[model samples]
Target: MRAYETRRGARLSAALMLALAVGACGGSTEKAEGEKPHAAAADYERGPHRGRMLRDGDFALEITLYEEGPAPLFRLYAYQNDKPLDPKGVQVNIALTRLGPKVDRFTFAPEADYLTSPAIVHEPHSFDVAVSAARAGRTHKWTYASYEGRTTITAEAARAGGVTTERAGSAMLGETLPLNGRIEITPEGKSDVVARYPGRVVSMGVELGERVRRGQVLARVESSESLQTYSVTAPISGVIVEKNVTVGGITGGQPMLVIADPTQLHAEFFLYPRDAERVRVGQPVEVTSLAGDHRLASRIEAILPTADLTNQTLVAHVPLSGPTETWRPGLGVKGTVSVGANAAPLAVRTKAIQPFRDFEVVYAKVGNTYEVRMLEIGRRTPEWTEVLGGLEPGTEYVVDGAFLIRADIEKSGASHDH
Candidate 1:
């Protein structure tokens, strides 16, 4: 992307390019010199060639510009009437007003063909250029826009072009540590229904996978020690995932059913060796389902006693919160834990950023005008990037469809360096 000059300069560049192309493809028939259009005396009266011109009685100063190495250079040509006048003791100063309501002023020194500004110029060339020169005990000032790399479209047209705007602002962005997690049974969520004493199972009331409440009779047994009947009850309220007792089998003190709370499944997030040191209890976490649709919020409640020797990854238990949809034991998940935060003075969605003029830029919308602004960026994340300069807070800018605007501006040739 390039910084564009004013519309007048753009047209002049196009005309110049067209002339060059036509000259390259000229036909055999040569027209007489008389057939060619000539510059009349009046053309010199206002000063010939490009630039903003100012005339004070007999003295005329025209400020023309051309790109040198990195940016545009301004030259001031002084003319006494229609003939060239030596700059001699003439002094010139130029003021450039750009976006952000900022101004850059440059003083000129006499060079070979014209007076050149001393400063190293840069892009975002579009601006209101004010030129003032003092000579012959008189001073003249003129103001004209060098509107390059800028475009204005009506709101309706912008809407038709799918342009959307957002105010530049600040946001809290945290450093994310990526993790892989899976739902599994926690010690607290597991319950074993066992016989208190050795007995012969007489009646079995509950089946496998059945839900039971605490103190509910899961089976009736005849105790061998006293030859009496006893009721075996569920110890915890949960789903009965396992049942091993038979109606006629004699028990030697063994578990009858295994109950686990499926509704509140235990989730463990695995961290690599590099991230394990930074992970701690109570750090914020986001658990996303493998489908990347469902999500639940939780924190690092505890680290598992052992690490996976095969992978060298440690498991952090993150008990999920709220109701879960399609979340079951052994379900794979993604975990993003926040280890630190970075607050920026200004930040925007990374999608809003575009490459322009060798810098990362986002189209800033000032009313109906969309102008290119070079940005100084800092720390960034996949979702947001920090804005260091070239933008102000509360300024509305294109956040969506900025790429389309870039295409349109390129097609318009507003900022093209001919």
Candidate 2:
């Protein structure tokens, strides 16, 4: 079936070619320089010019300055052979203009021996590209230009914010290891808070977003079955963290008055099983809350057993010794747990990592460019992922809008093909 299809296509192509040839003979032609014009039917005897048609395919060419050191070299594929001309002996016309004025012409020594099949050409040509600067007192300006067929304006007057690029040399490939999470003081351990047991709240003593102290009567409840009155008191002596029981609502053994020791707050985070192995009980953990600009230096207090059933996460509890004013529960934060191993990995913000199917991806900042790197994730918590491979420590990657940066890099690489 495939061979039959191929033959059918070839026959169709041959018919189209014959029709084009006949139509070209019927078209008008321009007389040569100083030649007498032929009659309408007499010009049909002259066939198509091979020079113009052969220049249509494409030329893989590179242009560089002969003397200007460190100046950028422009690489382009001039689509010249558009007129059905054979490129075997076609002339190549190159002109250079600076600041919209003609400066020089480059005539490449054409060789038919360098041609390849499928009409693709790879050639490098260098010439002295210099523009005479107009010196006005202490200031002067210069320009650069190139042309293939028509006069193409390559550059314009000097200005900032133009297309500037550079080639990067050898670079270090570092592995990115994600941190556990932002340390947060668990709300349960803080103030003198208590839960109302099997009772319906009849009234509330405190309003929402209000502060209550230890032993404070925050609400009143009644037994759901027996109608026995009960007063919901603060369990621990701290500010009210939450008021779970609403007035006139029945709560069965639920926490109604949430109180904590405001001054004794600590951060709790989760690590993956792989990362949990690196953390010790006494290792220092640098805690930073997203709710504020402050950071607290704390230590890993415990590595809890049993994975969190909902997430399969290994929990790491860190106690903060700093002032508790900056730390709060339910606020998103992040911190790094110092792994005592000799091989410390690079850390990146958790927001920058994107999950794809079963793996994770992060945008790594390579010099001034960003690249999409597939991460070998060993462990992950709410705020960080442990990088088993594919990143380095201390290197800054795009934490904000990393996916956007990756998209832009891919788009830029695709545009270079043109």
Candidate 3:
């Protein structure tokens, strides 16, 4: 299944290759006189400063992104004929067109031995770069692509691949306490049918496992004192779980039938000493069957004051509603109780988070393109995760099928080359 999904993603990627070309920065389509096009930044030769070297005859400029400090900034080293050139002697301007077609322009000023860009280079560092420099009445220009953690897919293809998106915004993040329990019938939902007076059973009307309604005749008993026959009816509407009498059997002292209402059920979850203090009545809980195939949303209906002598744990009862076909008495269940919640200024769906390289990332969407946004995360719950940094609040991000984007980017061999 994984291989087939990957193939589908590859097809989608192929369909967007043409779109990528229009925004591609590799191999210059236009250049100045006597200037030649260069390969992408990944293939460019690194100068002594470890920055990509762009050359036009004897004049060359090495561009490096300096990030050792608080923020990333652009730095340029000028050279002539393999020898260092005076920084002040060269004038340079750079344009970076990001995935959203948003352009960031930077002008370089001579700083120490190299020209520096005062503006900070934002994260992702993936863009189409255009560099122009002038010195000694001569001009040099170059353009190349430097893309990483980015991929493009047509809208049609995205829908076909189940790709979905949502805007990053405020959300309530909850803190939960986990507990284990089992489904049980409520006390009021069960009843034991018995004869009103000592008598002999004349006829049994219901069998084990048979559903019955309240006041339905369960057995006909012949009273010993009156020496007359009377009907014993079900006290509650439920299924007959136990039948203790038959025709011609003596009743009165023992229950003739035991009926239990399956619909009125509750999950009794055990809270250890450490977690008991945090749980209270009326808090919401999410209960799932032991097999995890069924789930029900409920709230803590009550908490027993006394602890069980065997386990020394208090019981928290969560009432279950809706269809009870999957929830049977004695079936074990898992529960998550919401103890508290806090509002987060900016958050994203937890499902959108994916591991990219060394950081936890989510793919931000713009048109047909998607790029990684490494996040600084804070409090997290199963539904929403607080985003402390690396993403804008109103930005649209992939909420599903993010793995496909990551796979496509990896297939393109996008790297962190300087």
Candidate 4:
């Protein structure tokens, strides 16, 4: 019985030794051979179910991949919860790479030419991507710039979301149609210079054909409400074309005297709905009064969207260049608006750019430097001149006090760097 018991103990000890030897071999294989039997299972648990988090500068990018139908679809999302991200200066690039033989060629949806492959059909595929761009400076500190002669707004809004009413001048993509325009005199704008509180005309400073400046007193009116005879100044300076009331006439709401600023005497031209589409609020126009001698230069102002029911025409206002004495209401005037082809080049404000002999020059504000660029020239009018070449659209160019900055740039030899 003692001998049988000792044999049983020896067999149990041998079994225990065999188990310890197997455990030691497994640990050695894991460390030196780097063979993880559970590696595929661990990757499957953590890879697709858990997304990859990526950070670039101030931007945070999150990419999630999940098996959808036949392919593993990836959904990419970007967030900047901690800080604001400027869209202007940021650029992103993405690439997909194949690791093992199982990985087929991968492709991006929506058909991007930059995509490397058609599609990843097998397992063990990886996507490598990066986000890189210049960080934009504070938008509020950006100065005023002009494109095609109009003002442009850049930078983020001073308010939370941003200024919705603000607009920036579009850069010139290519040759575009010149904006249609017409001109109007000052009195053409809406006004109510009626004799609302009229009295006796005590004095008359303006004559029938005299050109008056704005706010010039046309005549004086004396009423019980006005106390002593008070002067009624002209709301807009033009010419006193109509004198309805004499020195002693009692007046009420009727017009006491007709005062119209020739420059303000804008003619609201009724354009056919189709024709109006070619015209814009800032286009240049040539005005020829019925009298023929009164040739005036003007620009298209407001374009009323609603058409006249009776005339079926769109009404547009043209602001005249200067005060004129000849333009009067009911007097017909002929306006010639030049409608160019869609491929024609357009002019921008001359204030934003200056002429440098044969070439045009503008100061481009890049970083803290103002670089002067020589540009090609095109058609010219009084208000604006065309840009044939040199500057890109959407890029900020100094408009206000541009010449002063150009002088500074020239003095500092900023152009030497370029």
Strongest candidate by lDDT: 3
Q: How well is each residue in 6-29 modelled by candidate 2, as lDDT tens digits?
A: 001011123223211110101113
Compared with the true structure, the alpha-carbon lDDT of candidate 4 equals 0.44
TM-score-based ranking? 3, 1, 2, 4
**Which 10-residue window in model 4 sums to the lowest lDDT?**
1-10
RMSD per candidate (Å) reads 10.4, 18.6, 6.2, 28.2
Which segments of model 1 are wrong by more than 4 Å? 1-97, 100-149, 153-173, 245-250, 307-313, 343-346, 349-359, 382-384, 392-417
Q: Please identify which of the two predictions, 1 or 2, would achieve the higher TM-score against the true structure.
A: 1
* Poorest 10 consecutive residues by lDDT, candidate 2: 1-10
Model 3 alpha-carbon miss at residue 119, Å: 8.7
Query: Model 2 — TM-score against the truth?
Result: 0.35
lDDT by residue (tens digit), candidate 1, 1-418: 1222222112112322321111111001111111222242112223475554566666777767667556667777888775777776688898877765679899988888688886855556666666677887877765545555566666665665567898989987778888997888778778888887788999998888788888889898888899899898888788899878789988775687799877777678877788999999999888888888788778889986454487677789988755645688888889888898878879988888998767888888876678777788987876888888877788888987787656546655454321
* Candidate 3 runs further than 4 Å off: 1-10, 13-35, 38-42, 46-51, 59-122, 130-142, 154-166, 198-207, 219-231, 243-256, 273-280, 306-312, 400-404
Better of 2 and 3 by lDDT: 3
Best by TM-score: 3
Q: Each model's C-alpha lDDT? A: 0.71, 0.42, 0.81, 0.44
**Root mean square deviation (Cα) for candidate 2:** 18.6
TM-scores across all candidates? 0.62, 0.35, 0.72, 0.31
Candidate 3: pairs in clash: 25-145
